[model samples]
Target chain A: MSVAGSDFAVRVEGLEKSFGHWPVLWDLDLTLDWGQLLVLFGANAVGKTTLLRILSTQARPDAGTLSVAGYDPVRTPNAVRRRIGVVGHQTCLYDDLTCRENLVYYGRLFGLTDIPRRVDEAISRVSLGHRADQRVRTLSNGMQKRASIARAILHRPPLLLLDEPEAGLDQESTVMLQGLLKEWAESGGAAIMTTHNVDLGLAWGETGKIGVLADGKVQVQEPGRYANVAEFRQVLSSSLVTRQRN
Target chain B: MVLVWKDILLEVRSRELVISVLVFGLLVAVVFNFALDVTPQRVTAIAPGILWVAFAFAATMAMSRAFVREREQGGLEGLLLSPVSRDAIFLGKALTNLLFMLLVEMVLLPVFAVLFGFSAMSFTLIGTIVLATLGFSLVGTLFSAIAAQTRSREIMLPVLFFPVILPVIIGAVEASTRAIGGETTVGLGRWLPLLAVFDALFLVICPWVFSFVVEE
Candidate 1:
């Protein structure tokens, strides 16, 4: 539960992983600072989620090193877990528990003091207070996603790992999420978010890094590399097509 | 404690595990009461075996149910993603299963007594039940974690659970039979302590094994 004295929020180098005969992430390298956000883009079956899993200490890599908040994931996974909050595709909320109950359970798991206050704060952060008492199974998909986000940020960790966090969100909810994330980034928390929406990813990463994952590697680009979204979109499409051809 | 609290809350809300296992245990006793040709002479011996079988199958059913909620709903992943240690998760789950099995046993023990025509309820029998249930719950919780990772988990749980817990079941049957027959010497001399030994051994080993296997 102790934070390592490192400037970077996440660091990975020469990382490799595969499922059976299909390689997902190979020789992938990434680094994010404490106040930065990285929006990862890839094809449908690419290794974006896989990489996030490895970074979050949920999965081990086949080779290379992973450091989250300056601690090695393989050796000190609990420390890494203590420092990061993840919003995965699964929602990770118990269907039978109310949104507040789910947050309370997770808050207890993280060993947070003053759980009721923390739970209320997280629900407010996600704007889920109106539906906080409803069971997760009874909520809309968008509402459930917000609840999941609430659970993720309940601990107020230094890092956030989000996989398709905006998948089922409506326009307003998505904007709210963006605003929350913007505030999170501004408050010196780091995040790595993956999405299929290229324009959205570009917009989100405009202040940090945008990464295109293709052919077992990531091509990371800084915001200043391109002047506009269309140019960046063309470059990304061509890179993906070329990688697919290879 | 928090994990167990959540499990208890869920069970309280759903009434799934205890109710299903209670009904299943009762059905087993009923079926055996009719299926077996138990004369007064054989009732002492035969009833013990039937009771243990009922308890074992019911405990196995409970074990399967325990993990299905977590696995089917991605709750296990959520647990892993949290800051809790694996040992806490294993102990919490095993304790909940033990509590649940004990609850089912309390209701079924008397019903079995009525169905099989024996005076029931004693400290010896209760102690024996606790020891036996502890052993199997410890082992079953570990195997349940393993089986939850497999495809045919419904079949896999019993297939993996029964053989590993045979000693506990046998000990339970022996101790229950002696306790019912009022053979304090035999019940205390061998079976109860043996069940305790198995429980202790599994209490140490299962959590260790669980820590190793719980990681995917």
Candidate 2:
């Protein structure tokens, strides 16, 4: 593994993906580094999930060179997969299993030997230790989402890709999730998350990077350039008004 | 190795697959009992075929649910995101399904023997059950994973499973019939080879095909 610089964790060049005849991602280029929390903001059908899936090795790119953790995702997906964790809309958990069981199941999948301790730590980290033995199907939507987060981070991969992690989450839950992301970034992990909530994207501070993806193209990339909270809010409101007008 | 055990442990607690397969197998056996009007001797002679049929249908039901349940809970993507090899996932699912199918077979065997008035305590019959169930579950597991991603997954599973496991079914039924009829080991020479061939083919093919099926 070659760490070209202290800042780079992912380098994607000319990444292109197509489903049948329709292209989903076209010549996409992005680079992420340590302690960076990047939010991909996009609306429906804009290829947010497709881009994340390709980056996570859940889908293949038709053309281009992409590298995550110094391994090419297209050619050596398994190596890239080892360094990344993804959370998508689907909870991807066994409903019949308990919260602890779900975490242990994934922990073992990643070949973590101290499974019981890891499961307990993850459950507590998600603040679900009280419901650890409860069946996942019995939990509330927010609780289930937390369980999904616990499973995704069980291996502590350097790169995290979350597809709409804030969708449908209430304010309190969203705040808690944001705090978790902040801590993860502080610990030198890089995160790329896609969200429909523009407010959540703007709330991420200096360590955060924001990208606007519309119609499969990254229209804007803002890295700590918003003047202040008020200015960020104004930009967000104006963007929404413009979109509504269009 | 850990993935396989994780699947098994989860199944042990939930017991969903086993319960479904057992109930379905019993229902099929009862319906067949009333549907077929034959003497005790004739029923004993045909018991192996009926047993295999029940297992085939019941195992398909259990196997399809193996991955579908994960997909519904959003666990499939998590598993895909893990560093585990795709082949390990395939093998883990197949082995877990095999374990569930075997559990169903163990419970069904005595009930089947009682229903047909055949002796249940035969090592040869148990061996045949093991071989047949393994082959059926392997094919069933792979097909279930493939069908789970389709639009009509519930309807697609049996459509995909049966056609592929036809040879295994034939071999299992033939081998089982010979064993139940008190035939010597010589009678299994042909069917056992066929079962082995099918098992080897599936163990090789399912892993390769699974990488494609799980890709979004």
Query: Relative to the true structure, how large is the alpha-carbon lDDT of every model?
Result: 0.85, 0.78
Residue-level lDDT tens digits of model 2 in B95-163: 877877888889999998888887777777777778878888778877888788788988899998888
Question: By DockQ, who's the top model here?
Answer: 1
What overall lDDT, based on C-alpha atoms, would model 1 receive against the true structure?
0.85
Q: Model 1 over residues B1-216: C-alpha lDDT tens digits?
A: 999999998889889889999999999988887889777888888998998999999988999888988876678888998878888889999999999999999999988888788878778888999999898889889988888888988899899989889988888888888888775554367988899888888888787778678665
* Stretches > 4 Å off in candidate 2: A1-7, A223-246, B183-186
TM-score per candidate: 0.94, 0.91
Docking category of candidate 1: medium
Model 1 C-alpha lDDT per residue in residues A1-246, reported as the tens digit of each score: 224488788888999998887888898888888888888887766888888888888888899888898889889989888888899888888888899999999989989899999999999988888889988999998898888888888888888899988799888788888887788788888898988776677678877788888878888875557897678787765544434432
What does the lDDT come to for candidate 2? 0.78
For model 2, residues A140-165, the per-residue Cα lDDT tens digits are 88888888888877777777888889
Model 1 bad stretches (over 4 Å) = A1-4, A222-228, A235-246
